[model samples]
Target chain A: MARLITWCYKNHWMTLTLLFAPLLLHGQVNCLIYDAASGERIACELSLRAIQYRQGSRNSQLLFDKAIEVGPKFAWAYYEKSVPFFKRGLLAEGVSLINKAIDLEPKNYLYYRAYWYFYNRSYAHCIEDLEELYTVHHESFTNTPGGEMEMRMILAMAYAQSGEVEKGIEWAQHLMDTYKEQPHLKGQYDHHILGVLYYLNNRPLMAAAQLEKQLEVNARLADTHYYLGLINRENTNSTLAQLHFKKAWAKLQGEGGGHSPNIFEGFNVSAQDIEGML
Target chain B: MRPVSYLPLIILLLTFSTFACLQSQANHQPKYKIPIVTHDLSYIPFDPLLDDPNFQICDSTKISSGRNRLQYAAGRNTLRSDIVSRFSPQSAYESFNGYIVIRFLANCKGQTGRYRAASLHLDFSPAQAPSNLEQHAKEVVMGLNNWSRATETNANAEYSKFINLKIKNGKIDHVVL
Candidate 1:
């Protein structure tokens, strides 16, 4: 090695010229992983983390641009960045990013889950992702208490949305049973999801029961009253329906009125619904 | 002749009374109150057209992500709730629905300022405009600190943000970002 270095030192100008010639001609400084589109290197973990910090701003989009510039192959960055775009109502951009993320990491169930729900709106795809995540790749994701509960909720919703009522009911029941032991964990959203699932699955009695459970937990939600009114109306109980509707109306119009923040994307419960009933 | 003398004295008294009334009228001036919307400008000054596309961080050509967008909506709702909770208007009369639109400047550093009411279309049961609610909205907007700033090249670049608060009856229905 020493003899070779000594020999190269005598021909340093030639070597320098050869290196400069290619760089000048190609207009490319060779990055280990170059992205032709962005004329930059691929992203790494650090780049992805940087993007996450700035995720709160519109500038985060540009940081995503920069992340892709540094590490185009970093699938997580694409997934992380897609969420903000979707929240901002840029569905197309979000869809494209999630797709790229999934394509790069096809086995990543979280990416698929995001893609199906946020980008494609296909419940079947969501079911597929959830099943694969739970059964095939259970060890991959961090299964904290909150994370596990959220996963179950997602699975339940996916099944319900995909017309698999029985499976949806089973999962929702599983969720209820699991959390029932811990009273503090049984939140309004849990009942809301179960109630919604039962309603969509043609189980009115069960739906009403679950919705009523929400009231027991906390009666502040305008949604609970509105939904109860809807269920009563379906049962042809005009007086009961009217009562619930009035409650909901009061809650919405009165000083202490408010709705649950835990809302699903496609499931809409609005004040307009109450107005239409009245 | 005595009656004629009394008529002169009465005429003089009437003239004095008229002059006193005119003087009082001149002294009493109508007081007009101009409402003020408070705001903080510690980072950058606000621009008139904060939501201009050329200077916006999230412009028409691009979009915000789903999570960030959701968070922004939630933040705006919280602000609305804070204002409404602090000064809730009465809602006993009839059904009502409308909105209040506010425009403000948010720079790249996430600081907000120069909050102005774009429009206020609130209707209540008693049929009086809720000046308190409107003021609270303005105060909330002005009180808002570091927001995610626009990434536009201009250092003083501001993103124009609009918060449309929908009210049903006297309660807050929802907020549109």
Candidate 2:
């Protein structure tokens, strides 16, 4: 009986060790470098920016690929890969990659943002993604007032573009009104919304004011000049209109600017004509 | 006689324990001596008159899983060389909504080299798939493979290894060497 007890003890010990072996053997896989101040993962953020800015899609793609290769389970890499695809008109691939990202990191806001941008482009599609982003990450924007303002401006634009012109106007007005009182938002009003609203309301003067302000703040804002040019042309200010038009054309040159004939028609401009002006 | 029988059993137990300890130690062993390489470039220039404003440099080396730090030195020269090689004057300012392929060689140990290819796919997110996504991917891979193979065949070549490359959308998201 004593020998039997000893044998059982030995077996029990071996079983315990075997069961815990894998857990103990698991090593730290990788370390991500991040900005300590922002608590933003440096590599992931840069990857996102690369995709967002369309700086080097090829390089960004490689970086994300490398990121995933190094950490197959990392959700951000998949999310990063989706952006360039979506921007370059590869919607299906973008959606698939974004879904993968959401699956891997269900709680991440970045994944949701990617999806939001996707559906926001077409109003008849998934509006829920935008709502989800607004609800889940409502607080993140509040912390960064500038970022919040920018996001609100984008959301307003998306709403307007999606054909919810009334709702878009409402959001835009809300952004302008809410931030108007704050000193921080003094110069950063909802110019896109303001421009769109003035245009929609048939107030060309107001629309031009808002858009011209946007251009002044950032000359590289090609879309602003494009819209301003449209308004200026409608107002019959040919020289100023031409200037704005020329700027838009210069900014959009060689970017497949006229690929979407539907969107370009509204501008009443042609790529060839714009090139001629340049 | 029974005590003598227990001797072999003890020996067997001790030997098994030693082997297990060695295996665990090997598995947890740290890589203490990894080779390091540094690349430096002066500048990456962009011609606003001819180059897309959105163009930026990417370091393909950073995509590796090894403990090597890769960086691209950004300035006028580097940018000019890269853009000049990849684009034409007529198409220089064209916004490319496609991927580019980059290849690198991995030198392992003292006298061995391995070729690696990475693919970049660029596109917007959260929508239905784009029409040209697949074709772009195929072209990127083909370009990388062609370049790597061609480089490998040339003697006294700048690049001696062949790495397979692929791109999906406009980004390079996969690499296999």
Candidate 3:
């Protein structure tokens, strides 16, 4: 013990890292994670213990698989193991691994799988996962996997993409009504999402109104400008349309148009697109 | 007599307990050093570049996963949209929706290098897109010229990029930049 203290005293930074690695790696000190393996509403202290040693990396991922072998019921290990596969473009392997997590714990991972379907632009597959979560299970997912966007809003967009625009509008309206009391909706674009759908439905007046409200809250998205431009163009207001198009181009230019994870646009506007509009 | 008998029983218990402690100590492996099996190759697989004969990586040593983009003027969105704008759709009305993932290399000389492409259906089952659609998907990416070279300590570096395109109804619907 004296020798260990001496070594730790010599290597202060390494000691600090060793002392606080888990909090640094995940920032989740609490075991609030759910593991559906036991078919009960319970937090996964077991899963946290399963991965108590390390988190995501080549070594960690292999360790996760070992943890799974040691405890086949450890659903979170499967989920953690699956993540790097998705990053490496092995969707087939990724989904297969996540499926083990989902089957073991649907309450936690259904929306995550749906997000992947959305990421892949498999609207039908996305809709299937979401509908099962909602209709069959009577569960409501408030946000996307990483909590960046609303899952119900994604459901609306999926419905819209699959040629059910009216159904999408209904879903969007429901999402807004259900979550209206919660301010910030976890920093998601509620009015912006609804505005895009409203424009798609040819409700130009409502679309314009909703998008204006969106801009009032958050005025940065290039897609919002692009949608507003399209709405203006449809209303035969060429001047406003061109102005909005220019603004959209400027946002793309100014913001560098980087796509953060879990954020998507209905219309991915380009330089030629803005120029053509102008 | 009773005290002597109790003493022998106590000694047997002490010996048994000490043997158990030694056995546990000898058998114990640190919980933290949980043995990992060799990582399964199928789970990780390989980057698409290794299989393609189209282009050789100009330099592999500096290959980064591209956390920093090679900055272009109009930015990532315009770059992606412009690439799609160059596409003359081959399978116009035929419904082929899913993903077109292209992994391409960028060298230190600000040039796009070798590429590998995969087309998948909505469920992520590999898709047999029309020859032209497949050809153009590869061609449009290979055609990219303007790449700002990655820099490491004020020197040029090489990197690879994943161009993940979301296709809907045989058209490029969204590009994840």
**Candidate 3 docking quality: incorrect, acceptable, medium or high:** incorrect
TM-score of 3: 0.65
Candidate 3 Cα errors over 4 Å, as ranges: A1-56, A184-187, A232-246, A255-262, B1-63, B66-100, B104-119, B126-146, B149-158, B165-177
TM-score of each: 0.46, 0.38, 0.65
TM-score of chain B of each: 0.42, 0.23, 0.60
Model number with the top DockQ: 3
True contacts kept of each: 0.06, 0.05, 0.17
Give the Å error, residue B101, model 2.
17
C-alpha lDDT values of all predictions: 0.54, 0.43, 0.65
Q: Give the C-alpha miss distance for residue A10 in model 1, angstroms.
A: 82
lDDT of 2 by residue, B27-47 (tens): 993311111112211112334
CA error at residue A54 for candidate 1, angstroms: 3.9
Candidate 1 per-residue lDDT over residues A14-73, each given as its tens digit:
455455443322121234454444423445434444455545353455555577766666
lDDT of 3 by residue, B92-150 (tens): 52567777777666556655655667777666656777666766787887777666643
Name the best candidate (by lDDT): 3
> Tens digit of lDDT per residue, candidate 2, span A198-255?
7876778878888777655444445566677777777778888798777777665534
